[model samples]
Target: MCGRYATTRSSGTLSQLFEAYDDTDGRHRPDWNVAPTKPVPVVRVDDAGERALSLARWGLLPPWATSPSAGARMINARSETVATSRAYAGPFARRRCLVPADGWYEWARTDGGKQPYFLTRADGDVLALAGIWSVWRGPDGPWLTCSVLTTAATGALAGVHERMPVLLPPTRWEPWLAPTGDPSALLGADEEWLAGLEIRPVGAAVGNVRNSGPELTARVPDVPAPRRAREDPRSTAEMPLF
Candidate 1:
């Protein structure tokens, strides 16, 4: 499960890469360790059929949910049941979105302990983790929540973990972003695309949400004890996702 990841791209670069209109409410700080429940950038087709780069709470809250807190556990939806699951079927049919990430973090158990690794495209392409979203209303107001889709890992990733986010390829981006019916055809894991992926061990600091820096993702030989991550007072609140 992708409980932690990084999205260190500048807003300008992502706007052009996804050809999306910048819809974030304010400046988004680069995050090397993004955790669930935090608002992260997402690219999706608006009703106008134009791709818009917007922020969304990382956890998905079904439209019928009674409490916003339910979102935390809904951070990832399994691919096998997404089309039929009560919580995800509606969004799968109409609210598809592409989650932007430089890469994601996955931990592997070894003789020493659990070691974290950062996975990214070998050519440095941004990962569009397939996602579904919902618009939920509560006492506070309406919220745009999203969940990343996961499938059994295939390729180098398989040795790391049995499941990983369904990373979308550029060729399918247009169709997947179309605001229409279910696009299950475009939601499967792609080994051909995964062939170009690169994985490397990084500091254990990434396990801490307080960590925010390029060094957290810096490749390390073998992480023994990760350095303590500094805290950001303003980070606890989700960033604006307009």
Candidate 2:
């Protein structure tokens, strides 16, 4: 599960990379440690056939939800069930999008404790993760939200975790950004694409949400500690230390 990640690209760079035509909202700044429930940039197609870069809350809120928190627990949607899940069915059919990220964080367990790792494309290109968005209205107001799609990990990532975000290749960007009906075809992992990625162990400092900086993802020597059978989800709420 991708609970926290990092994005340090400038608005201009992101716009150019995604071919986004809209002006920047100026509200988003470079963040080395972005957590769930925060606003993140997403690239989606509009009615005019142009891609617009916009900010949407990381957690997806379904139209039937009574409050924003209703979907806070759904920051990610499993690729296998996206087409059938009630909360994601509609968006899966018509509101597909691309979530740009410099890299994502994942935690692994060792005899000593849980350690964090930062994974990125070997070429250093931004990851265009497959995502879906929704417009939900509640007693408070309307909100634009989205969730990242995850698939079984492959290649190097398989050893670290069983699941990883589905990354849309450049050629599939247009189709994914304007998906119609079911998008199950884009749910599988691309072995070649997966091979082009790399991972590095980082510090556990990222376990605290308040910690933010480039160093949060810096590589650190692995150390052994008493093993814990399970990890608490809240332990990943902050930037992971390497």
Candidate 3:
């Protein structure tokens, strides 16, 4: 459900990484807590065959949608079903793109509460999440939007969550963007691509959409140890608090 994540790289760095020719908009700054519906950088191959870095709302809005707000619920498409879903079918077939991110946030739940974890590549390279874009026109105007693709989690990530975004390695990037042959072959790659990934426990400040800053990723001690029902004091009491 990738509702929030982070992207702190400078546009110049992203331009070089994606081979994008456009000049930096200067309006974009490093954000450690990007929430849903916000504008984020996306890399797509233009008709001229040149890669261009552009900002697009982080949710997918199908052309058939009556309004843009519908995109808020379409931020992610399951890799297994995107090819056939009405909201994602067209874009998944032809509007493939890349979403650059420094890291992503996932929540792990325990009896006490849910904790946020920041996941990133161990090599410190920007993750190019496989994404699909679409153009939605409404009473306001036209808008370019995108959504990330998620696959069944594997390796260390599987322990944290059952799903993770589809990550495209350098060798598969071009093949994913412009499929000349079997597209299904490009969908599920080897787990070695994300073997070196690392996940760090971060402060829960990111849980709040209004909060935004680099400190959101700061490491915080895990407190309030979770207690099993048999070890809970309330379980021994005559009645529960609730």
- Please report, in order, the local distance difference test score of every candidate based on alpha carbons: 0.80, 0.78, 0.77
Q: Candidate 3 regions off by >4 Å?
A: 222-242
TM-scores for every candidate against the unseen true structure: 0.88, 0.87, 0.87
Ranking according to TM-score, highest score first: 1, 2, 3
Candidate 1: count of backbone clashes, pairs at least 3 residues apart or interchain: 0
lDDT of 1 by residue, 183-225 (tens): 8888765656777777777778888888888898778774442
Arrange candidates, best lDDT first. Answer: 1, 2, 3
lDDT of 2 at 68: 82
Superposed model 2: Cα runs more than 4 Å off: 222-242
Worst 10 residues of 3 by lDDT: 233-242
